[model samples]
Target chain A: MIIRMAFTEFKLYLREPASVAATLGLPLLIVVSFGLLINPGTDTSSLVTYFPGMAIAFSLAILSLNLLPTILANYREKGILRRLSTTPVPPASLLLAQVAVSFAVALAMTLIVVVVGHFVIGFTVPAQLGGFLLAFVLGTLSLFTVGLVIAAIAPSGRAATGIGMLVFFLNMFAGGVFTPRETLPDFLNRIGDFLPLGATLTAMRDAWSGSFPQPLHLLVMATITVVFGLAAAGLFRWE
Target chain B: MAIIEVTNLHKRYRDHVAVHDVSLTVQRGEIFGILGPNGAGKTTTVECVEGLRAPDGGTVRVLGKDPRADRTHLRTKIGVQLQESQLPDRLRVGEALQLYSTFYPDPADWRRLLSDWGLEAKRDTPFGKLSGGQKQRLFIALALIGNPEIAVLDELTTGLDPQARRDTWQLVEEIRERGVTVLLVTHFMAEAERLCDRIAVIDAGRVVAVDTPSGLVSRVDAEQTVRFRPSAPLAEHLLTDLPEVSSVRRVGGQLVVSGTGNLLHAVTSVLARHQVVAADLRVEQADLDDAFVALTGRKLEESK
Candidate 1:
């Protein structure tokens, strides 16, 4: 049932140029363009290694914060969820559909970033691939769970998008996705250290730079995955 | 046996009362209409029966099981078409039907239902692209996709053209012929009178009357107007003194007698005795609209 729903949802997502462009196209554009500007740098341990993971993180933020919440809230605001509730099947299947599609897109973005970085930018693959995979899974869970909470709180699709956009930029800025490391303030850096996206990005970058992920970062993502995930499940409404 | 039963149903949102002490029973193979003005708790009542809501103070039973408690079980046997619910804009008609078909253990064929509802030509059309009437038809088709024994259709034909309304009414009759009990919520009197086997007239979140359409019309006891031009000048006391007559008025040269029960016979006998011919006579029977007015102290059309 979830597969069928995801197929239809994927169709809808494909037709949405804005969502496709932001979540999928944005990361590839960043990778290819930036990689060309810098050319083939021999410093694989520097930004080149972290950049692939960062691009994947960016895709996760787009999917979990902006795209997922906006679409789910729209379904509720438009009575689509209410309509589904009348059927024998539960409406929670829609959440599953969202998770499935978001993860698939996040994976695709990660593959593109890594492949483009390795072949075009001379970046080596992650030494601790297991740690990288674990971080990716935990990060997806925690981020998507926050997305569910946002979708639940917003009264309508348009409202969800507004809130999603605000949170997305804030998450990115605090996590240092766009800011240079030295230029960021100490207070903002400390604050981002506790956030799921920030913690997950740091853990992923650690694994990608040929080392095991930080246990503290892994613990933060795991705690967020449990807390926000449960809150979202408890607060969700079909209408 | 009654397919649906509601007892003293009450629903409130914050401090505003939406449904207050409303109750009705729908027997098997019956087309029960709930007639009321907008915001009169009609939708709230049906929602309780559909298990979409848990009544604040009442019991709702569908097929001998509580709607809220046995929601999963009731869902297979009962179908619902909500008043304001919609699908995703990009969801195609055929896809909607096909998706709903997977919900029930025993479902109707989507292709057959599409053609039955006159939606075969619109199979590929997206929901947002369909006209008002087409959307209504799709809702009905989706409601029946489960092949439910009971279908709760709330405001099924609202905002449709007269022609489309009539066509939908025919489709509803076909649904009834298949032995599906229907609980319909509507505001149109002509619709209630034409399709409803029995109607529960609701007003101000309360049920004012429950009876057959004609039975409701008879309950009002509102007057029928008899209008005609008297051929010759006559003593006004002869028409005024009749017990069956309520009021005698002169509208431009015509004498109009408004009363109930044999007013026409009394007035005509009086005219015969006085040798005054009743020219251009017309007697209007009090219809459902007048009955609605008498019961609710407001016109149905005016309520909207």
Candidate 2:
């Protein structure tokens, strides 16, 4: 039942052209546009990780912070969840379906970025495969949990979009998506290390450079996932 | 047999009471109505019966199971169309019905429901693109997709045009013909009169009356008036003398006679005896609207 619901949700998500463009197209555009200029194949600098990290961060932020919250809150605002409660199937199944759809979209985009970056853009694949997988899983979980919390508290669809945009921009600026941490002041980088997006980008970059992620970055993402996941579950309203 | 029984149901939100006390039983294979103006707690009452809400006090049983306690089980038996609930804008009509059909153990065929509800042509049309009447038909279709024994439809035609409203009413009758008990909620007097087998008139969070359409009108004072232009001058005492006629007066060239119990028949008979031709005759009888006013001391539309 949940699989059927998730498939339906995925179909609905595809109908929204603007959402598809923002989540999928925008990230690929970032990677290709920057990859052409940086010519990361010949360059030996740490700057090779910069473009791919920014693309991943942007895609994850849009999917988890922007799209996930808006869709869930809109379901609540429009009474779709309320209608589902009257059926034999519980409304929580719809929530799970939504999460499944978002995760599927995120996973698809991640693979596209990695494959295209390695083959087309001439960047090396992450050598520390275990570290890369761990960082990616923890980062996705934490970011999606934050989005769930936003959906739980937002009163309406428009409100969810507003709150999500605010959080997305804040994360982008503070988490080193806008500028590399190498260029930022020491205090900002210190603060960025604790943010979910920041911890994710740093850990992912380390794994791409053939090193295990710092324990501090992994701990920060894990803590956010647990705390925000519990908060969202507790606060969600079906109607 | 009663398919649904809600007894002394009480529900409140914060300091304001939404449903103070509501009690009604819906017999199987009948179209029962909960008619009331806006904010009269009509939706709140049906919500309890639908198992969407847990009443603050009292018991609600549907198919012999407590609504709140046995919600998961009762949900398969009772289908609901909420007042303001909506589907996703991009969800296609066929997909919505097909997806909902999976929720039930014994589901109605989605393809048949598509044709049955006149939505076959709109199979691929997104919900946002459908017209109001089309949207209402889709909602009704979704409500019955589970093959529930009881279908609870709330405010099914509040925003429809007269023609569309009548069309929807016919569809509701079709539902009853299939042996599914219907619980209809609306504020439209004509809708209740035409569609409901029994109606419970709710006012100010309480049920003012519950009876058949004609029974509600008869519960009123049963006063009727007959108006006509007298071809020949007739004595006012002629109408006043009849037991059924309580008062007689003149409006321009017409004489108006008001009374109770066969007042129109008594007035016309008296006119025939006097050999006076009654020109432009019109009889006004109390209807559901009038009964609503008499019971609640306020007009239905005015309460809105």
**Interface root-mean-square deviation, each candidate:** 1.3, 0.7
Tens digit per residue, CA lDDT, model 2, B1-304: 9889989989999999999888899999999999999999999999989888889998998999998899888888888899988999999999999999999999999999999999999999999999889999999999999898999999999889999999999999999998899999999999999999999999988999999999999998867899999999999998999999889889999998999888888888888998999999999998999999999999999999
How many Å off is the CA of B235 in candidate 1?
6.2
How do the residues B1-304 of candidate 1 rate in per-residue lDDT, one tens digit apiece? 8888888999999999999989888899999999999999998899888888899998888899998889898998888888888888888999888878877889999999999989999999999899989999999999999989998898989889999999889988988999999889999888899999999999989999999999998987778889999999877788889988888899989998888889889999999998999999999898899889999999988897
Per-residue alpha-carbon lDDT of candidate 1 for residues A1-239, written as tens digits (9 for 90 to 100): 67778888887788788888888888888777776776646453356654666677788898999889988998998787887777788899988887898888888878777887778766677778999989889988889988999998888899888998888888788886776333579998777777778877877878887789888888989999899889999998788
lDDT value, residue B193 of candidate 1: 94
In model 2, how large is the Cα lDDT of residue A21? 94
Candidate 2 recovers a fraction of native contacts equal to: 0.94
Clashes of 1: 0
